[model samples]
Target: MMNDCSLVVGGSKGIGLEIAKLFSERGDVTYILSRNKGKWLGNHIEADLSNERNLNHVLHYIRNNKIRFKYIVFAQKNRSLPDDLDYELMIQLKSVKILVEGIAPSMEGGAFVFIGSPSGRFIVREQPLGYHLSKAALEHLTKYYAVNLGKFGIRFNCILPGTVLKESNREFYQANEDVSNLLKRITPLRMFGEAMDIVNAVDFFSSEKSRYITGQVIFIDGGQSLEGQESLARRLTFGED
Candidate 1:
């Protein structure tokens, strides 16, 4: 059953959920892992990525299921804006380290795709939250993992989105006016990307099409990054800024 199973961490909602659906749609028996079931549609694991004990349990689940896979898709984000760097580091490192450790030795010759955001590359002149800093660290981690795992037939890569528009992002879109308009102009596609956009790219990586691509950060933002940091403040009000 090699290449028959696909494991997706944080696949309950948003981009992660979409990636899980893509795997299922393509006939890969997908396992959706998450701490809580949440409101997303998918079969899910009730375990915490930040918890070390749960990581052990996660491994047990994989082994007991005898699930060999051709892909491991990751879509976890550190959603914190703490005043202290240490606390923030713990949150960011926990998800990346545990998942990297759990999936690497278990899944072989498989493509590993992570959903990343543009915050890691261009400092959004406006959104300087620790979450963005954490993402930057993750981009580096992606490269590091790709380098170390290349010999094992493992490919690690990420998709960075400019503005992943969804129910979760509706508030952000409403709050940031200029950022929204800029998205309309720059993206050559001239439209906001749906969850499917990220899913399609990840699917490519999982299949033979992207067997040679690794440690790369694909920007799914259309041409939004080209708009520069100024787009960060596109829709801010006097009080919000």
Candidate 2:
């Protein structure tokens, strides 16, 4: 009998890394696929998803090893070229499509959770247009795969996170007291979410608890999405009511 296998794409750092850690802690045979090696308790496959050759190599390695993934997470983001449409599309959407198609055949039954952004539906001025487009498309991709792959007992879902603090942006958020406090005030939960919050949602989706759930888009934003944009903006500009 083999232990359950899990794959975390772009798991080298931040929320992705936290998700990988969760799987490893639960005794899953975890694999981290990223351009750089992550400091985590798992097998690290250093490959750039944007490179066609690297993508092929990753698929081949998984197949050759007969690794059957029970949970797959897509957390890859193109931070280097924020304004490049092609780069954003390739990392956020194309890579997910290719990897899922390649791995779905071997998966017995499991879930694929996409780490998307609230900007998928809402506009974040700080982010580029390409980022918004790619994220919006990713939501549909999740649903598309869910509908087609249901016969294989594989579930697909997307998670849209808002203002979640992680390793990469923790210092920035901690230092910016005004912005941080404003975000908390606008959120219905009155708090900023942590990386573990997203991890918990991923864990739920991958576990038997969500066995009957599929094609769902969950927002792990500490209820930030509940507030209207105008209201949020007013709060940001006027320092709350």
Candidate 3:
């Protein structure tokens, strides 16, 4: 019921869609920018993150429409590893950077949430190198903006999700029984998180409830990052022995 305008990038599926749904349900003017129009019957702007011109168009559309944003969420998901570094960075980081810079000026002290990964903070060898690198850089960039843009009262933060079960990832988690079991076993919660879990985090940050928090990287990963670091340390210790 709050008067807010939100722009959700990559809102076609997975985490982005869930975030957009939350905004729509709350009666916010939610604009989804994605290449594919999701089944969600809400406002949508079809734009490819890899295309800078498309991103620029979205920025102009928002500006021309005078959409003053209260929340901006970057929830783009990279399911596959790309061979080209430029393409990978473009999708994962560059496009988001442009959108944030473009829209930040119009924000009235709102929050910008980036859906990041645990791989960004830690060394996760099993993940695609390009994705890991891009996320790591994205996380750093999140902090950079937080420092630079705090004067304007725009909050920038990142949420590092663990294995959040989504329609897109259901099949992969089902197929990789070993990986799923290992993830559950290591996590203190002993269960994979659902999309709602992440949406809740975004909801908090987007509201005045978290007005004082910014430049922080919060992990909603059920302690998976801690477990991963512990496992890595143990491996190193055992190798020396």
Candidate 4:
């Protein structure tokens, strides 16, 4: 029997936790994994996603409960330095691959939503190079999986969010006024996004609303990625102040 269950990795806080909360509110059997337990009143599985043994424990629980996920969200992040690229790749890539292998058999007809970043598609030299490179690789991996797993009725897509203003990171943004100005000035929307925006996108992908969509990368970046010399050229041509 197919169950209304979801597995949210790296969901203890930030965007992932918000998505998990949405799932739980809708009465879905949600499972969350992160270093710390979130404030939600649902199941929170403690596991270091980068550690094989820890992930094994999580796999065991899923197998024991016979929980088949209808939605799988990979919201994991690794903000380590360039020197720690190996650990970052392990957590953001290898771990996700392992989780998919472990649970994909039960994911027939389900949707896989990867919480990627705008860095995946565009060149971002300001941030850690490792971070940008890993996400780029992840985007390709999403396409590869989408093609291979389509036969099993599984759909894969990526949500590339940019400059999301979450409550947890309010202080960081407030302290970095220059960065905040750059984000606002570059984005066509002239504003930063909220966590709920991404959650809403995920909801659509996970439901029948997007049944025909697969192997797509949706950017929720408020048009920030649409800026650069092209934007300047357009302004010069149109004389828009």
Candidate 5:
């Protein structure tokens, strides 16, 4: 009669926090793993993903508690040292590898959803080379784990998001009406995605509805990825056609 459990890495803020909230509301025993303690109503495991010792401590805690996860989401990112390749790799990729390998054995046929970025395939000038490289590798890593862990009934998938309106950058978008309008014009959906947009997708992947789905890369960008690069650049540089 154990309660269903879920874990959200980097669930202290932004999209991660939203995802964690969804699980908490659904009556799951949700755990938020992050460097700082989250204000949400869930079990908080303080761990810096970049630090191996911190990760080890988290693993040990979970093992000791015998927590079998029904859903595991990775929404962590390190932008403090954008140019530091090692730091970016450690936070964005290595931590995921360590946790997945360490916890997959305890999972009783659940899903692992990675929150990635469109930078995985396209170059985002604002982001560093390491960010793009780590994200690209994360997509592949999702497929790799899905293939290798299928026998164990674990599913792995990645969600690559484009421009989404979250708490972190909501003000920026609101203040820059011109930029927001331009984004709307270029995107097929003619709107920016919200945090709930991502939460819904994660919920789907975590539920039994997506039991047959795995190793898939889904984008929830309001069709922004479908826009032509040249057209977008032209719109940004000049007036829209």
Candidate 6:
């Protein structure tokens, strides 16, 4: 069953923002996580992902306050560009796990969401190797947690989004005719997916709507992974059916 007081890690901007908005409207006490402070419709928690201590502190606050929660969505977004190889990918996953560990005790059989990228499940570019590796490991972690949390009636799942257009990337794509045209032609939907698409799915699975579901990886791509994902012919469908 769904309950009030949900925590959304990386919920301050982009895709996370959509999730926060939906949950808040549903009357859930939603907590949005971001390192920077700004005005949001829902409550905001300012903290960096690399900071383990801060993660623990927030978790401790929730526990101390006896804030029972129903959903914990980790849409913690990070993009490892070709030049940004120095970033430690594991840090993101570990940080999310820390928060979950703290909140798990207070959850009454809920859903745990890990926002992953389609690159981890399918073809990965040579440039973002660390990012791909991290997401792949995240899937394994999700499975492990799902198995353990099963006894507690909590579900663990991952969402792999393909070619999500963030603010910076959206501008780049819109400006580049060649890149924009090619991407649209390849994806069956012939368009890019909005952040709301992802958040809505998380909300459904995290609510009582997905109580019997667990250990699943949902892809939010608009048939980009279809068997015929090419410059020709209709592509076969894939993911999150």
Instruction: Give per-residue CA lDDT, model 3, range 79-174, as digits (tens).
Output: 554656778888998998898889888777989999988888777776667788899988888899999999999898899988789887889989
RMSD of each: 5.0, 2.0, 3.5, 2.6, 1.9, 4.6
TM-score of 2: 0.93
Q: Against the true structure, whose lDDT is highest?
A: 5
**Each candidate: what lDDT?**
0.74, 0.88, 0.85, 0.84, 0.91, 0.76
Q: At residue 199, give the lDDT of candidate 4.
A: 98
Better of 3 and 6 by lDDT: 3
TM-score of each: 0.81, 0.93, 0.89, 0.89, 0.94, 0.84
**Per-residue C-alpha lDDT of model 2 across residues 1-241, encoded as one tens digit per residue:** 8788999999988888889999999989999999887576569988887787789899999989878899999988786888888888888888888899999999899999999998899888999988999999989998998999999999999999888887778899889999888777888888888889899999999888999999999899888778777887887688775
lDDT of 1 by residue, 1-241 (tens): 4337887877777778777877888888778877665665555767676667777787788779766666887786545445545545555656667767766786668788877667777666655466677778878888998999899988888888766678788889779988887566556566788777777888888887888889998798777666444554553333222
Q: Show the lowest summed lDDT stretch of 10 residues, model 5.
A: 34-43
Model 3 Cα shift for residue 222 (angstroms): 1.0
lDDT (Cα, tens digit) per residue for candidate 6, span 1-241: 6457887877777777778788888888888877763446667777677767877787777778777888888877564333453344635567867777878877778788888877677666654676777788889888999999899999999988877777758889888989887777677788888777887788888788888889988788888887443435433233222
What C-alpha lDDT does candidate 1 achieve relative to the native structure?
0.74
Where does candidate 4 clash, by residue pair? none
Give one digit per residue, the lDDT tens place, for model 4 in 58-114: 889888977878899999776444547778788888888988888888765889999
| Clashing pairs in model 1, backbone N/Cα/C closer than 3 A | 176-235, 177-235, 178-234, 178-235, 179-234
Stretches off by above 4 angstroms in model 4 are 1-3, 79-82, 172-182, 233-239
